[model samples]
Target: MLNYGILSTASICARYIAGVRESKNGFVYGIASRNLENAKQFAKKHNIEHYYGSYSECIEDENIDIIYIPTMNAIHYRWAKYALECHKHVIVEKPFVLLKEQAIELFELSKKNHCFLMEAQKSVFLPTTLKLKELLDTKIIGDIKYINLSAGFPGRFPEGHWMTDHASGGGALYGSCTYTVEFLSFLFDEPSYQYDAHFIKGKGSADDVVHFTLLFNDIIVSSVISMCCALKNEAIFYGTKGYIVVKNFWKSNGLDVHIDGNMTHFDFPYTSEFVYENNHIQECIEKGLTESPVMNKEKTIYAVKIVEDLYKQM
Candidate 1:
């Protein structure tokens, strides 16, 4: 079994641990934090076997076959690079890195080290998302002319939290829009043809709202992401024939397809939305693959580039 070491005590780590337990070929072997006590508590609470005070110690542990980095957006590149250099397979959370160059550099380092590396984008590995892609490929909704994705919630972060700090990779674009960009890349099997974006920042805060439009040849895609407001939180693909609606698109377990005034609903219930991605990672490791065929390097680089360009416009 692949022994997984997690790099944070963030709330998401709990969910990731649950998913790893549900996975077929992996387990949470350890957890690490900047504080030794925090690491110990997290390890005990999650039933992890090992705990380390420093990230370096965790990555250096020979027993850990994979290191999962769920740290902040800005530091993902640093820890991922460190783990890769240590010859450990790495899984980095979404918004892989702040810059496209960082993404390229990390992938190159992974290759040089002969280690597996993937951005942990659970949305694309979700069953609902896979079904959506299948439907699009089969033209179940005819030709898709336009796509609309809206994701947001009234998120309240504590004062000085990284989520509201632009330098720390805070803001709606890094936090939520990454989901839309990576999701589209996965569905279309290509990045957007071209794109433009607009941002809204509150006083002394990062961009709280973002509206972006992308063109994929004949198809037009529009998206709005926010941390300061509530949205419908769904994705709609408008086709020549009809449209498909995916509720909670980021962690969706079901979707509804509308065609000919008929609506068909599909559900794929799961205990943990992250299990699929965890299983995929193990499968790749077992196959001696250095990169995921689905969430490959090119898609990651393209997604990061899209965000980078949007940030440049900000």
Candidate 2:
């Protein structure tokens, strides 16, 4: 079994914890947070045995082989680097890091330490996403032209949340648009793409919204990720032949394929999407692979480039 410990008590852990608990090859051996009470309560609620008052404790614990990072958008690089230096495998939550430099450095550290590392991009690992990619490869959507994705939640965090701060890596792209970028890169090979971005600053630490357009060779794709106003979420891919509409990219529960105005529906597997990711991580480690085939280093770099470009625009 691949023993695991969550590095944060953030809400994202709820999804990942459930997935690990449900996975046959994984176990949530421990949990850590800044607050001892939160750590203990999370551990107790999940039926987890060990709880640590700080992230360092979890990293130092010998029982855990992998550290699952579900921390804030800004702290990903720091904790991921710490986990690697400690000789622990790492599965970081999406967007991996704020800059391409950080992503490259973490990958290098993993190689130097002889440990496995993976970025937790959910869409690429979920069965539903795989099926959609298969369809795209079969020309189900014909030659793609434009894809639009929008997602936002109103005041999901506190008044002065980091997501509202630009320096805090606060923006839709770093926070939510990672899913949309991952999807496009997955289908378009992550290369031969150009990007553009704009951000709307709010009173918080990051931008309230982000708008970006992607160029895949000759194809044009656009996405709008908002966070300032009310909550709304949607993703859809348009092609020469038809389009696929996904209700929520983050949840990734279901989708609709439309061709010539004909509709076909697809529901994601009943199994937790995060479970599939956990399963994939263990399988890669067992196979002695450094990264997931679906979300390999090159693609990881490509995804990072997209983010880097967006930041430049902002």
Candidate 3:
């Protein structure tokens, strides 16, 4: 079985631990935090075998086959680099790194170390998402002409929270926009056409709202991501014949298809959305693969490049 080392005590880590438990080939073995007490408390609460006061200690532990980093966005590069240098397979949460250069360097480092590495994008591995892709490929909606996606949640970060700090890679662009961009990249291959983006910055220096448009051949794709207010949180694929509506597209378990004035709903229920992603990681490691074929380096770099370009404009 693969032993996973968790590198943070953040709330997301708890959810991740729960998901890992559901995976067939892996389990959380250790947890680390900046504070010794926090580490101990988290490990105890989660029933993990080991706890470290520092991240380096957890990475260095001989039993840890993989290091999962779910820290603040700005610090992801540092910890992932360190983990790769230690020759441990690594999994980093979304918005993998703030800059595209960092992602390139990390992949190179992972290759050099002969260790597996992947960005933790659970959406693409989801059963519902895979089914949606299959339906699109079969031309259920006929020739695709336009696509619209929006995701948003009310901003409720506490004072001084990382989500509100630009330096910490806080904002809708990094926190949420990456999802839509990466999801599009997965559904359709790397975009070859032109694209443009606009941002609206709120009280913090980071962008709270973002609107971007992409041209995929003759098909036009538009997306809006916001943290200031709640949106419909849906994705609609407009085609020459009809359209498909995916509610809560990011982690959705069902979608609706509209054709000939008829609507059909499909459901792919799951106990934990993270289980599929974890299983994929385990399968790659078992096969001694250094990178995921589905969420490959090329796809990751392309997604980051798009986001990086948008950030440059802002």
Per lDDT, the best of the predicted structures is: 1
Show the colliding residue pairs in model 3.
Answer: none
A best-first ranking of the candidates according to their TM-score comes to 1, 3, 2
- Candidate 1 matches the true fold with a TM-score of 0.97
Give the per-residue lDDT digits (tens) of candidate 3, residues 179-281: 7877877887656647799999878787788899988779898999888878899999998889999888888899999999999999999888889999999
lDDT on C-alpha atoms for all candidate structures? 0.91, 0.81, 0.89
- True lDDT of residue 256, candidate 2: 87
Name the runs in model 2 displaced over 4 angstroms: 230-232
Candidate 3 Cα outliers beyond 4 Å, as residue runs: none
Can you write out model 2's per-residue Cα lDDT over 78-124, one digit (the tens) per residue? 99999999999999887788889999999999989888998997777
Return model 3's CA RMSD, one decimal. Answer: 1.2
- Decide which is better by lDDT, 2 or 3: 3
